[model samples]
Target: MDKLKGKGKEAVGKLTGDRRKESEGKADQVKGRAKDAVDEAGDRAKGVKDSLRSDDDR
Candidate 1:
């Protein structure tokens, strides 16, 4: 969501020649990607834990 929004902002900034907006847009993209990486890592950990539990049940 943020990534897509940031991309739009960046595109608009570029089209309108706004340096501040472009910088902000770039920052937002980075922040969004960082959040996604954290979420994916957490999900992977949960999956591993669930698999281990299932194995133990057998």
Candidate 2:
């Protein structure tokens, strides 16, 4: 999602030779990656919790 958009912005910046845009694009990519990692962690945690609940019910 955002990662793809950031990549597009980065490519456009490089083609247009916009240093500011290029930097912003790179920042966006980093932010996107960080957010993705956080989301993955949250999902994993939820999965573990769900598993525990199911096991307790059984």
Model 1 weakest lDDT span, ten residues long = 49-58
Residue runs of model 1 more than 4 Å from their true location after superposition: 55-58
Residues 14-40, model 1: lDDT tens digits: 999998888888988998999999999
- Candidate 1 total steric clashes: 0
Backbone clash count for every predicted candidate, in the order shown = 0, 0
Local distance difference test, each candidate = 0.89, 0.88
lDDT of 2 by residue, 1-58 (tens): 7777888889999999998888888888998999999999999998888888865585
Show the colliding residue pairs in model 2: none
Model 2: which ten-residue window has the lowest total lDDT? 49-58
Candidate 2 C-alpha error for residue 32, in Å: 1.1
